[model samples]
Target: MKINYSPSKNAFYEEEHKERYLLSGSWPGDLIEVSRDDFIEYGGNPPEGKTRAPGPDNKPAWLTIPLDFVEQAKAENKRHTDEANNYINEQQWPSKLMLGRLSDDEKLLFNKWLDYLDALKEIDVSGAPDILWPTPPAEPAS
Candidate 1:
């Protein structure tokens, strides 16, 4: 089994089901080969609340997930909630539905978005990279 570095995952794939990277062939990143001992010691995936990154001289090293991650998550969640609120409140979509201007499906979609926005606002990013983000109504959120 060969270990390949995945910067996006911030960790190494000890065997990395080839289909995910080799077949897709779209993940552009480093190709550092890690020894089995290193993999065993540091783990294929970074430890909880931490991430892998290139350290001195570009060698793989484990680093704690930084405080910036919390701030970043807060900003992202705010952006999503703001957008959703704009559609529901600022745009008066619910009023449109009440006035028979919108379809039932659109109202349902907006309702789901309302729940998703509330979930986003309640997220606790104190865990930084360990945070579990809420899913969006129509798609995956950051």
Candidate 2:
């Protein structure tokens, strides 16, 4: 029986039994080594990988966003949006005063509130993993 050794797995495969065995010290036990092949045979590997292809060099990258931060941002976004809407609804504009006729202070306050709403709209809460916040670039070789 020809034995095929895989350095990456640190195991040996016997063509006779069509099985792979793990290397423990100097002894090869009867324990069958389970590989990706086994998972495929049993339909263990999920199809999710197909949809989300790996990053560069087939390696996967992950982003860690704090749960508390996400929740707080979402809450703040809702609060600001509601506050802006309420301000618009409660204001009683005079018949002679158009939007442009508003006082400087009123315009500034309204614009500030609208700016907050715009910022909140831009916050992405899809929870999708991203590499936008990458590690600092490595220094160039001297």
Q: Pick the candidate with the highest TM-score.
A: 1
Query: In angstroms, how far off is 90's CA in candidate 2?
Result: 2.2
Candidate 1 structure, TM-score to reference: 0.49
Error of 2 at 61 (Å): 5.5
Model 1 poorest ten-residue lDDT run? 133-142
lDDT of 1 by residue, 1-142 (tens): 8876655465666555756766678554665777877667666656666666776645567777787897887787788788778767864777897798877776777778888888887887655666687777663243
Error of 1 at 137 (Å): 7.5
- Tens digit of lDDT per residue, candidate 2, span 25-86? 43344334344443233323223222122224322222245566556656755776776667
- How big is the positional error of residue 63 in model 1, measured in Å on the Cα after superposition? 1.1
Clashing pairs in 1: none
What would the TM-scores of all predictions be? 0.49, 0.32
Query: Cα lDDT for residue 121, model 1?
Result: 74
Which residue runs of candidate 1 sit more than 4 Å off their true CA positions?
Answer: 4-32, 40-48, 91-102, 115-142
